[model samples]
Target: MEMKNNTVEVNHIRKAYGNRAVVNDLSFVVKPGEIFGLIGPNGAGKTTTIRMMMDIIKPDSGEVKILGETLTEGAKNNIGYLPEERGLYKKLSVIDSIIYFASLKGVDAKTAGKRAEELLKRVDMIGHRQKKIEELSRGMGQIIQVIVTIIHSPQLIILDEPTASLDPVNAQLLKEIMLDLRKQGKTVIMSTHRMNEIEEMCDRILMINKGRLVLYGDIPSIKAKYRNNSVLIEFQGELGEIPGVTEKRPHDHAVELMLDNKTTPQMVLETLVHKRINVNRFELSTPSLNEIFIKVAGDERE
Candidate 1:
C-alpha cells in the first residue's frame, strides 16, 4: 500500500471480549511528522488500542487507517512498532539481533547490516555490537530494541514505553532521537506513563481513562484549559505577613500562593513591596500535565 501524509486515523473503534468492552468508541488522528501520545493508567486499554492499530488483534467495531489505507500486510512495512513486551534472543549478538529483526520487516541483508551499525553507533551501543544480548544491561537491550523498530525507516513509528528501563541520560537520548525522526517527517505514536516525557516530546496527546477518551488536544491548550489562575512567587523575606495571601505552598526554590478572591497580582506586588519581602520573581502558574492528568483521571475514579 502506498503511504499518505495522514499516518494514522482511528475512527470510533470498539473492542470487546466476552461481555465487557475494553475500548469504547475511541477516535483520533495522527498527523505526519507529529509526536502523538496515548496515555492512561493501567487497565485503561492502551495496549489493546495499540494492538488493534498494528493489526495484531482485530477490533470488534470501527476502522483503523494507516497511511490512509486500512492496515494490512503491505501496510506493515510502512510502519515501525516497539511493543511493551521485550522480544529479543538472549544468545544473539547485538548486531545479529538487530539484523534479524530488520530482515523480518523486508529490509535487505546488506542494507540491514549497514543500518544496524549506524543505529548502534547513534544510540552509543556500537562498542558492544559484538556482545551477546545476555551480556548487556537492561538499558542496552532497550536501545537495541529501539534500533530494530526503526531499521526499516517506516513512515509511522509506534513506541510503547520506549524508555521504561533506560536511565535518565539514555532516556533523554531516546527522546532526542524521537525529535530527530519528526524532523525527518516521520510520524511517531508514543505510549508512556511518564507525564514529563509527554509534556516535552509530544505535539499532541490523547488521554484515555478506563477505555474512554477523557482529554485530547495540544499540550499548551490542554494545560490552559485546566489552569487554576494562581501565581508563583519567590522571595527572600517573610510572606506570612502579607494579608492578601490566602494560601501558600513551598516549592523547591519558590513559593506558590493562592490569592484571595478580590486581590489582584498588582495588589500582591504592592503588599510585598510595603512589607519589604525582597521579592525576586512573581509569575502566573499554569497547570502541569501531571496535575491535569491526575485531576481528570482521578475525578473519574470517584
Candidate 2:
C-alpha cells in the first residue's frame, strides 16, 4: 500500500463474469502530477477497470492502491470521478447540483457556492446556473457533470469519456481545464476514445485490449518504436517494386511504404531515385495514434 510517489497502482487485477474474464491480470502504475490515459475499444473493460480502481466495484483478484493508501471513506475525499454515464439530479437547478456535490466532499455551502460560480463561468455556463438539469442540452449536461466532478478540487481526478457530448468548442474548453489541472500538479486519469485528445494531453498512456495491456509507456517512446518503421512517398511516374519494402499502401496520390527489419528510410529513398521514379515528395512520417490503436486492437470481425 505504500506506493511512495505513485498516485495509483493497479496490481495483477482480474475480474470475470461467469466463465468469461473481462479484466485479466491487469497491472499498471500512474505517476503523480501527470495526465495518464486509459484507452481501449468498446467493451474492452475500461469502465470495469476504472470501477475497480474507484472502489465502486471490487476486483476478483489482486489489489488497487490509490494515492499510496487503500481506498477508504476519507480517501474518497481526495479523489474526483466522472462516470461514463451521466448522473445528475434532473430536478435540481444547476447551481444547487454543483453545491450539493461539493458539500458531499466537505465543502461548506458558502464556499461551494463561490466555487460553483467560478466553475460555471469558466465553462461558459453561468447563464444556465439557475436552470434545472433536465432543461439543459446534452452538451450542457456534460459540462455540469464535469463541474460536479471537480467541485472539491480533489488531488486525483478520473474521467471516463469526459467530452462525449460536447461540440468542438466545448470539447476544447474541457481540454483546457484538464491542462490547467495538470499545471496545478493534480494527477488525472482520462479514459476516452478520442486518440487525438489522448495524444495531445496525456503524458503517458496504458492501452488495453480485451481487458489486457497492449501498450504502456510514455507517448514519445511508444510512437518512436511503432512509427519509424515506415515512410511516405509521392511520385509522378509509374511505380516500380522496391526491395526492402515489406508492404505498400496507396494513400491518395502517394504511397505509404512499410519497411522490413533491415530497411531504412534513406535506403528506400535511394532505391526510388536509382529506379528513375520521378519523386514529387519523399518524407519520413510517423503513424498517428489512431492508426496505432487500430493496429493493436485489430478488427472485431477478425
Candidate 3:
C-alpha cells in the first residue's frame, strides 16, 4: 500500500527523558484497517512511543505521521484514543459524558447522542446510559470509556490496556467491536497485557524492550520465528522422565513439554510407549505468544 493509505508511520522515532532513552530509533508501519498490537514488559517504552504518536509528548528526533500528516489539532479528530488511565465525568450521565466528548471531536450533539445510545446498547450498557458515571462499576465504566473514544467515529482508534477492567464476557464484546471497526475499514492500535488478545485480534505486532525493537512482524511470522520443537501430551501417571524433554509443565489434566533440538514428537511417543506409559493424545506445536513475549521481554523461565 502507498504511504498515504497507511494509518500510521513511525520513522526512526526517538524519545528521551534526561540521559536515558525512552524510545530508541523505533520504526514501524500500521496499515489501514488492521489491528496492530504494541506490547512489551513493564518499563518497555511502549507508553512513550504511543505518547509520541498521539502528540501528547514529542519525540527528540525522527517523525510520526498519522493518516499521512503530522499529528495536529485537525488531525487529532481523525484519531480516537482510549488511554490506559481511564477517566470519565463522575457526576455526568454516561450518555451525556460520551456525547460531550463526541462534540469535542466535532460531532454534533444530536448525532453524538444517537451514536452513544446505539453503542451503549451494543455493549449492554444502554440501561445505565442515563445514570451517573460514578454509579457504574469499574468494568461497566470502562465500557463507557471505549464508547467515548469512538463516539465521533474516528478513522483510527488507539486503545491502551483496554481490557484491563473488563471481565471475560465484556472483554469478548470489546473484541467484537475491534473486529467491527476493522470491517468498517478503520485501523486499530491496541496495547494489551493479555497475549491471547494479541493472538486473537491483532494482524501485526511490534514488540519492544528497553526502548529497542525486539520483534516486529505479522503474528504468524513472529510465532514461526520463535517456534519451539515441542509437544503437548495428555497422559496418565508418571512418564518416568522422558528423554529429550528440556522442560515439563504439569497442568490440571495434561502436561506440556519443551523438546530439545533434534527431538521429535514421534521419538517422545516411542519412548513413552516403550516405558509402558498410557498416552491419550499428543500434538506438536510452536511456542505461544506468551512464551515469545516472555523470551523477548527477558523474563523467560529456567
Candidate 4:
C-alpha cells in the first residue's frame, strides 16, 4: 500500500455498558511518524479506547478516524495491532503463524516469507523460525507476536503492552523496533504501563483517568504543566533554621526541600552560604510521568 500521512483522530468516543461508562468522551490526535502513547492504570478504559480506535469493538457513541477516513475493514488492513493478550496458535510453527497473519493483511506469500525472514533476523530469532509456538519461552512468543503484527509493513501500528513478557534486553529490542518504524514514517500508538518506556519512546502522550482525558500533550509540556517548581539541595554541614523550607524529604545522599510561597531558590542558596554548609549539587526536580499519573489518577487505585 502506498503510504500517506496516516493520522488517527478520535473525536469524543464513548463506550458504556449499561449504567457504567468505560470510556467517556475521550478525544486525541496521533500524527504520522510519531510515537503516541495512551497510558493509565488498569481498568482506566485504556483498552476500550484502543479497541474502539481499531474498530475491534464498536463504540456506543462517537467516531474513530484512521488515515483520514472513518475506520472500516480496509482501514484495518493498514494497521498493525499487537494486543496485550497473547494470541499465537501453539500448534503452528512460528514462521507459519507470522506468514498467516501477514497474508490476512493482504501481503502475498512470497513477500510475507521474505519479510518474516528479515524480521526474525532483526529480532535475533532467525534460528527459531521453524520452532513451534509451544516450544518457545514466554518472551520469545511475545517477540513472535510483535513480528507477526508488523509483517505487512502497515502504515499505522497499534501496540498494547508490546513488551509485557519480555526481559529487559528483549524489551529494549522492541523499543528499537518501534523507533525504526517511526523512522520509516509509520504512525505508532502504543499503550504501556511502563512510564520509562513512555518517557523514552513517545513523542506525545494521552493520559486517561476514570475514562476521561486528564492530560494530553508533548512529554516536556506535560511534565512542565505539573511541575511544582521544587528544587533539591544537598548540603554537608547543618543548615538549620531556613525560613522558606516548608517540608523536607531526607534521602541517604540528599534532601529535597519543598519551598514556601514567595521563596526563591537564590534565597535558599544564600542561606546555605551564610550557614557555611558545604553545598553539593543543586537542581530543580521535574515531575516524572509516574508522579503525574498518580497526581492525575488520584486515589482511585486505593
TM-score for every candidate vs. truth?
0.87, 0.91, 0.84, 0.93
Candidate 1: clashing residue pairs, number: 0
Q: Which runs in model 1 stand beyond 4 Å of their true positions?
A: 1-4, 234-280
Pick by TM-score: 1 or 2, better one = 2
**Per-residue CA lDDT of candidate 4, range 148-245, in tens?**
98999998899998877789999998999999999998989999899999999999999887799989999999988888756788777776888888
Q: Counting only residues 3 or more apart in sequence or on different chains, how many pairs clash (N, Cα, C under 3 Å) in candidate 3?
A: 0
> Over the stretch 1-302, how does candidate 3's per-residue lDDT look in tens digits?
34357889999999988999989999999999899999988788988888899999999999999988899998999889999877998999997899889888999999998888889888877899889999999888888898998888999999988898899988988899999999998899999888999999999999998888889999888988888778888987777777899998876677888888888889998898899888898877778899899886765223
Listed per candidate, the RMSD to the true structure in angstroms reads: 3.1, 2.5, 3.6, 2.2
List lDDT for all candidates, in order: 0.89, 0.91, 0.89, 0.88
> Higher TM-score: candidate 2 or 4?
4
- lDDT score for residue 183 of model 4: 94
Error of 3 at 28 (Å): 0.6
Best by lDDT: 2
Q: List the residue pairs that clash in candidate 2.
A: none
Write model 1 residue lDDT over 3-114, tens digit each, in one string: 4457799999999989788999999999888999999988899999999999999999999999888988878988899999877999999888888888888898899999
